[model samples]
Target chain A: MAIFRTCPDTGLKIHSQAEALIKANAVVGIVFLAIGGLFGIAVALTRWPAVHLLDPEWFYLVLTAHGVGVLLFWIIFFEMAILYFASAILLNSRLAVPKIAWGAFALMLAGAILTNIAIFQGDSSVMFTSYVPMKASPNFYLGLILFAVGALIGCFVFFATLVIAKNDKTYEGSVPLVTFGAITAAIIAVFTIASGAIILIPTWLWSLGFISYIDPLMYKIIWWGMGHSSQQINVSAQVAVWYAIAAMVLGAKPLSEKVSRSAFLLYILFLQLASAHHLLVEPGLSSEWKIFNTSYAMYLAVLGSMIHGFSVPGAIEAAQRRRGFTRGVFEWLRKAPWGNPAFSSLFISLVLFGFLGGITGVIMGTEQINLIMHNTLYVPGHFHGTVVAGTTLAFMGITYLVVPLIFRREIWMPRLARWQPYLFGLGAGGISLFMMGAGTLGVPRRHWDITFSDAPLSVDVPGTAFLMMGLNGVFAILAGLGGLAFIINIVGSVLIGKRRDKTVARTNPVVFDGGAAVAGYGAEGTMKVPGTVVLVATFFTAFVLYYYVNWKFLSEVWPLS
Target chain B: MAIHPPADRLWWKEPLATSEVIWIAVAFLWGLVMFFTMIYWHFAGEQNLSSEAYKISPEKFAERTEAMAAKYKVREEGDTGVPVVRPPAGTDIYMFGRLWEWWPVLELEKDKTYRLHLSSLDWQHGFSLQPTNINLQIHPGYEMVVTLKPNKTGEFSVVCNEFCGVGHHTMVGRIYVVDAK
Candidate 1:
């Protein structure tokens, strides 16, 4: 028999085992974030050119650690927490196997520790891609393999929990939209982990000298199958959090369930094909293959993102209109919970992700245009837009809500919480923009010195390139402070914040109507999202102008056939 | 609510509002436009990457690069003693990328096409030609052939953008493009 505790705030039954697991995964994830974030700051400072903090050896080593720690360990561990919450808590059902979940966490922890050890051991500094011939220690590959296996098992546990919910009839009708979104993430995780296993196991053996050689080209092709798909998993989970926050804060519903769900289905079909984007400038690939895969089968997956872009804010606008904030088209948006960190962060994530991440990603992924941008600072610039500004910020946003709801503790510093997202968002946004600017001016990525101070042949990088790096350094510090604030706030709240009492009002109640249909299709019985329509139009115009501008830039480069 | 299951058993059949329909249509059409634009570029665009590549042993590739360098040697660049080779227009010119440098700088003529053969001797490296900003991936055991026609006349720098150990930042090569006359 599973023990349960009813949350006084949300009035939902939470399984004790599942709650413990969620807390464990989330806390571990934050610990990795802290560790990796330190390394990240070091990287930014070193890249600043003015600072040039680390020596070449330490720079490469820290870069590897930062990538593995944050990208793989931190994100996945938090995703594990999300999987558990979406299944057990949302369905009001018990976790399928509590013991197995603990085992998975232990394995992941062991893997992360092992990988860090290998990185610090001083010979395994072959960056995250770990491209072949340039081998890291056997332990590095082994650690990643272990972590992938653990995550794969965790995905299975989530699936089993969903089955348990169905059989137990914990809730009526289909699983909640949040749970459905989580299901998409879990599905992608499984595919990604499997790809990791296929490529990594052999690489581990190769490192041990059991195998003579691993072809570099083949390694890249398969490695990105795991690497790029992993980021896709983040996209799915982040979008899910967006929906959850909107509903919790403002009682928002999807503008159309069919539209949103179909978009997610499009992800399942087309998103993984984007692994081709990395290989576009590589040798031995045909233009036809490159065109098809890089575009995600005619950019249908992009269509998926575009659809969500409209529906999410559209849902919010419609919800606000229903509450009688209907003086004008802008009234609904102006009256929104701008002070709420969760709401503010979600909005920041939406705009930055679409305008910066989404737009640049499509431009660089273009087969011909990639020639100008490949392996430049532009690549990192683009991902910072997606992963850091978009996914990481959104994850930070949700934590504010998670602290009070799941931990049953008041937020430690409410004032700090309100300002945290903007500080981080603005800082990260600047970093992305400046890095891209430097890249367009022909500054390379992963190089220790742009000035070529120590090289036989020198590069005459524009003075503006130095300015971009200087600005990146500044924004990095701001983002670092923002991250520190979040850590302090969460750690303080979890440890000593006042416990929630029955008398205290629920500011954002967890509302579920037992899957009962509500009357009215849109706000005020007629669909009206003039504000959202205008916002999306602005986004579309920016995207079009940016897309053509890149092609124009491509045209100016040296002619090639 | 997003945290709850659909209120209706048939949420799939729920009708979309006019705005939702219009937005989806516009976004889908945009996707189609971007998709076709790539295919269109192959026909009209001059900056597209060539798909010509071959498998060759590292030793064989190194041998070919040294032979070409010796045949077309003009003058050594600076105090480094690396040869600067000015291969004739429309010739098959070779540039080798390795642990620490792009060997034997090549000089080409403006507005003339040449087959530029690129390969790595040891680890994988990036063929990042700056100023003009053309980039490609270089892998050992494979040779990539790019059809290059330099429109501008000046010296261009090739910076290895891919991380290839401690000396990666130092891995730079040069190409001099002169007037066709």
Candidate 2:
């Protein structure tokens, strides 16, 4: 029988097997983050016209490495940890198959290492897209195949754990909202992994020359279902973490649990359709197919996000008000714990992801608007907003809480932890804004240099774009430093920070307050979230302004009648 | 942290607060409006390049482009020695994207619409028109027909934005919209 040690703070029983897996996955994720982040700094510096660090070949190589490392390896690894934690810990169930979980971990590690080796060896400098006919070494595709299969297996294990929890009758009605969010993420992971299998298995064979030809258009249409949907998994998981952090840090419950759950269900159904936006400008797809995929039913996914956008902050405000912080409408907003990394980072993630990532995504995903933004640096700017500012920051925030709860150690550098979110959020927000600005001025996304001096005709972009790229470089450095601070705090805390005494663990559970109002779900209150309503109103105003500004800019482009 | 399950585990089953329902309604209504706006833009003067495309062989595309270049090549004074082909207004024009170059600098008459047929010989490439900021993804075995009427007569550079190997950044094509005197 597996041993279960209930966390003294959260009171959720944690399986020894689950704790080990979470630690292993989180450590690996941080390692990939470090490697990918270094590559990111190089990429940023090279894009800075003043620096122009790498030559063409090396730039492409580093770009490929960076994309695979950060986007694929780091995020997926951490999500695996989250899947395990959400299921086994939150549900208070033993891991369904611990040995099988280890196997999945091994396969993932092998795949990541193999892919990196192929890229560094230079035959696989095909960038992340790896469009067919421009082939890479067989190992690149093989690596991705292994990774996807591993992740798929891990997801099944998560589902199994949920089943175990249900069968065991381990506390609850409809599985807490946090675990519900994880279930949504796990479902999306299944679809994303399947899409990867459908495309990558054949691509692996083609790379080895066993297969004769791969249609470029066919490859793109199928590949983005994997490519873009993979990000949707992150979105689902990140949103889950946001919910978890809110509840754990502030003892805040969902404003309406059913509404939040419905929004997650919407993600599983419609988020993948957003992938079609990537192929909107590609030949072979009809205007009807493009428009239908981008708008008709796809807006439901956007609606899902909008729902979460309002509800998350709304939940917090409602929680705050119940604690008697109800003097004025804005009292709840003013009384937030800005110093706690858990609160600060999640809050920043919400704001940046919505204003920068969410609004820009809607505009860019618009079929007509996609024509202008698809291949520019704007594409990267959009993702960095979502993945880095949104997902990575939220994950970082949770890690602060997780370190103490799971690892059983106090955070080592408490002072540095407080400032980490602001430094990173500000820096990352800058990167997104500057890149979008440069991209709007027509800077190419993957091009090594915008000023083609050696070419027959010298290309001259606006001086402002050069300034934007330079600023992006500076921000990358700042974000890199913030990432460094987080790593130090986490590693130092886990390895050397003082462990809690047994009495301390039992007596001082991670509760924010012992007050009945703080812990309750605010079922009896009026549920008036005036502060969040005002904040969301501000968000809408910005969204509307940015939305029309892009349209106005589109009107100035070439008159294609 | 001592864990305390919610006082009401079926909190979701409880009625939603008026505020929650109202916010959901507002967000959903906004989404509907946005969706309709896209539909409206599609019909009313949205400058998206027409999707109209067909399948083509790499060899056939290369052959037709070579023939057109041979027939219309003109070496004018101060030309960069790259061959410039001045075709008539309102004709079907072919562009071959091969290896690391977009072939045959095209010269078109200002204010006259031309149907440009674009395809790649080996790999996928991006047809990004700079200074004007129009971008389209071009791939092998597919012909993209973009009906473009150049209103401003000037030099516009077509930069290949897709990562089609290392020399992709250098793959620039030229378009000259000359005044038809």
Candidate 3:
């Protein structure tokens, strides 16, 4: 028999083994985030032109570390925690093969450590893509391959836990919407890891001198099959976090389960195809393949995200209305839990993601527009909007609740928690905007010096580019402080914050009723969400305008065929 | 709640709200519009990437690049010792990218088209033409042919945007577009 502890606040059955694993993964993930974030500050400062912190060698080295640490290690580790929570904890079932889960974690930790060591040792400074022919140390590829395998094993364990949940009849009907989203992420992860193994293993051998040569074009095509698909995994998990937070904080139910599930289904089917966006400007690929793949087979995956953008906030509006906050279109929003860090972070993430990330992504992914945007600072700017502002912020929001509910502790420095999201969001938002602005002036992405001051041939970059970089530096510092606040609050609460005992009254108990009683479909029959409709309309307008503006920019460039 | 199973067994059968129905229809149509736009641009727009490319060894590409440079050598781009070749309009112009530089500056006649051949000798590099902002990826062993027509005459800078090596920042080339007299 597996030991289970009943959560005092939510009254859900938490399997002890699953809880420990979740805590362990999350703690390790945070450590990587801190390390990666420090590297990020150095990168931002170096790119600032005026600040110009690191030398050329150290700049590239730290940039590579930053990418691997944050993009790969930190995100994946937290996602591993999310996989466990979605499977075992959400289903109220014991984890399957707990011992194997521990082994997976250990392998992942070892891989991450090895990769970091290889990177810091000063030979393997290849950017995250590691686009070979520019070979790094053998340990670099080995570390990544091992990390990918460990993550692959973790995915299988998640699947096994889902099977156990079904067999034990832990819940009724289909799994929850959030778990369904996790299933989408896990499926994508399996495909992504397979792609990594197929490519990276051979690249690893070539690094070891076992193979003679690797085709650069072939490497890129297959590498993106892993690289870009991993980001799609982030998108899936982030959306799931959005839904989970809405439900927990507002007691919000999905506006329509069918619509949301179908969206997740769309993600599983077509999201990986967006990897072609990276290859839009590459040689040898036909325009037909580029158009088909970059658009996700007619933008079906984009359609999925559009559906989610509406449904998440729509659900929130409906719930707020039910609580008698229904005076005007804006009342429900105005009366929302602005003081609560969880709600505030989710709202900020939703807005910045739609405006900055989603809009820029579609514009840049356009076949012709890619000519202007590919390999430019614009690429990084666009992703920071999505991964950092969109995904990372959502994860931080959930941590506020995760601490109180899972760790059973009161939030330490509640005041700082309230302001952290805004600080981070504003800073990240600025970084994305300024970087894109500089890129518009033709600033390169991975170049240590945009000014080209020491080059054999010098080119004059406009003064506006310098201003943008300086502003980006300022935002990086602000974002650093915000990140520090999050770390301190989370760590302090976990270590020595007040523990919730039976005597402590649960002011805002997380309402988990095991989904008993038939909740009404479609917001109590004639659903009225004027606020959500208006909000989505504005988003659509911004997207449309931005798309055309990029086309206009493309038109001004030198003519090509 | 999102964390719990649906209250109804047949949740899939539930009806969507009027707003959601309208939004989905709008979104789907917009997706179609975005998809067709790329295809439309190929036909209607002047700036589309050509599908013309060939597979060539690094040695062969280097020989071709140097041959074209020696034949059309007009001047040397001051002390750098790199050749400045002024290939005739409507001819094949070759520019090679290698370890740390974009070889042999090319001068072109404004408003005239040239079959520009781009290839890398060793690693992958990005062909980023600054000020005008046109970019393409250059990979070793594959020669990409771009149809280029310079509409405006200026001293354009060709910067290697792709991270080739530690010296990537120093890998800058020149392209001068003179008046078609």
lDDT (tens digit, per residue) of candidate 3 on A441-495: 9999988998888888889799999999999899988888888899999999999
DockQ for the candidates, in order: 0.73, 0.55, 0.77
Candidate 1 lDDT tens digits, A1-561: 899988775567899999999999999999999899889899999999889999999999999999999999989999999999999998999998999999999999999999999999988999989999999999999999989998998999999999999999998888888898899999988889888998999999999999998999999988999999999999999999999888777778898888888888898888899789899888879999999999999899999999999989998898887778888879999999898988999999999999989999999999999999999999989998998899888988888888887887788899999999999899889888888998888888888889999999888888999999999989988888888888899999999987766654355343322222334332212367999999999999999999999999999988987
lDDT of 2 at B155: 88
TM-scores of all candidate predictions against the true structure: 0.98, 0.97, 0.98
Backbone Cα, N, C clashes tallied per candidate: 0, 9, 1
Question: Ranking by DockQ, best first?
Answer: 3, 1, 2
Which model, 2 or 3, shows the larger DockQ? 3
In candidate 3 chain A, where is summed lDDT lowest over 10 consecutive residues?
A516-525
lDDT for predicted candidate 3 compared with the true structure: 0.90
Q: Tell me candidate 2's interface RMSD.
A: 2.5
Off by over 4 Å in 2: A296-298, A503-509, A522-526, B1-12, B76-80
Off by over 4 Å in 3: A508-526
| lDDT (tens digit, per residue) of candidate 1 on B103-142 | 8798999999999999999999999998899999999999
Off by over 4 Å in 1: A505-526
Clash pairs detected, candidate 2: A8-B1, A9-A509, A9-B1, A9-B2, A10-B1, A10-B3, A11-B3, A509-B1, A510-B1
